[model samples]
Target: MILFQLSHAAEPIQVDDGYTVSKRFEKYRKLDTTISLPKLSFTEGQLVEFDLRYAQVGQRELHLDLFHAVPNKPSKGLIIFIHGGGWRAGNKSHFYPLANLLAQQGYNVALPEYRLSIAALYPAAVDDIEQATQWLLNHSSELGISTSPLIIGGGSSGGHLATLIGFKNNKQAHLLTDKPIPLYNAVINLDGLLDVTSELALKFENRKGNDSALAKWLGGRYETIPDLWHQVSPVNYINEDAPELLIISSGQARFTAGKDKTKRLFNENGRTITIIEHENIIHTFWLFEPYLTNLAADIAEFLMDVSKIEQE
Candidate 1:
């Protein structure tokens, strides 16, 4: 078992308590007796590079852990999986097990740590994630990988960021650099919100009044910054050029706001979005066994299909 910890040259910024696999597993196990936590160990014949610094914002250094097959020939493609903590809490380690599993499947997987809500807010997280992807692409040759058919994905808030990054495709000006943002060939959204401004999102996200995690991350309530809410939504950026999408929902309708609308827009442009719904499961099912193994298989299949289509 290889354990990787977040490494920082300078003292790291103290953030709020973020989500962890053990805690989440405990919470969800009671709900689903069939679920088990996946062991966070290195997969056989896979290589892991930990704490590779990607970007720096002031005193904060953003880093990512990479997992890839040992004799990584015939690599499928790069998969950047972001971690979810409602944008306030959650570290890159949350997805280490998933990354290891994907690497075992002949995919190079990256787990990046972005500035959470408590550290920055709003576009900071987005920008950090974009920079992470850009860094990976810039260093791809050195890292011994071909980044074609790049795939971006995440669970919960990470999923939302991935969707937004994939759909936006660097059309908008980046907050951190003049370098063009990398485009993704496929997006795997693991139960992330499609539109934060949707009625269902507003109700669920703001159920705690003004103290909701969404509000904290966005810097205000939807009523106060309606335009910003719309601006950050992945649904608003859909176009014919958007990457192929694969959405896996944990039987949670509230988190999937604007899914139908986004699908409708895609259909209008003669595109289709794939969705797999898991009934009677917790929101973070991707972190648990059976579900995690199943998700890795689904993602690998989807990426392979997308890559095949892209090649043709």
Candidate 2:
């Protein structure tokens, strides 16, 4: 049986704890600190923030944290963020630091948590994310965000989920909304896997042991459920409609395979896929700053460039 193990294990990894920096980011730290309730207050024409329960009534409770930065000039665009923990563990709250930083830079951000595979399964997690995007679309007027050119991104497994949402046209029945969810304008995938079947098949042959990362995520050996592996892989569903995709990988063993699969998809579809190669960052280290700073700035610049065509 596939069992999920905490990658970080016992102690949580400390990231951007402020004290480690050469110069403390006093104001940014205060603004980015994870808090029970965000303390910033702004006028209507300025940045606004809130959380919304986007899941269906009487269903599992899911809350999405949103950050809106009203542009001094007409707004640029809105972006949604998904957190990655191999679809087992991760809280949207702890990831607020990323959202805060982006919001401060004039892009509205939404961070949502889906029911993990351990709690649910295949389409359930995808459904939760799709619903969050749908809810954002419905509330665009109230939230002060435009529906066009909405960008979606995340690191690691979140990157996988973001790509699935961006590439899959016929979303399965589970992620039901009254209407189709608005497709993403662009996607930022940070070290996310694309094809589980090929990856697992290779890993299994290598006898790398049950230490298979995705096997743990799927709750069993990939060999047992070959069909499920193909079904969930984003590479299987890519087509011309797949949004512009930006992939970043640290050239790790697990990630290189995914990058190859993604490149193959892009080649077959005649789409331009950009990859921001990193020096030696690990799976999800793109979420940390300094190391993340260059990528974040690139992302911010990319989104702004995309927004120029749609800006108010």
What lDDT, from 0 to 1, does candidate 2 have?
Answer: 0.65
Q: Which residue runs of candidate 1 sit more than 4 Å off their true CA positions?
A: 1-12, 40-44, 70-73, 170-178, 307-312
Per-candidate TM equals 0.92, 0.75
Candidate 1 lDDT by residue in tens digits, 107-130: 889999898888787899988888
Off by over 4 Å in 2: 1-50, 56-59, 170-178, 200-213, 216-219, 305-312
TM-score of 2: 0.75
**Which has the greatest TM-score?**
1
In candidate 2, what are the lDDT values of residues 1-312, reduced to their tens digit? 234333423423222122212122343345444312223335455554555778742434677888776566445567888887657666666456666666667777889878775566567778888888889888889776866677788877788788877777433322556656566677888777777667544574336434454565555566676776667688887776566778878766565356777788788987667777876544455445554556667777766655323312
Error of 1 at 269 (Å): 1.4
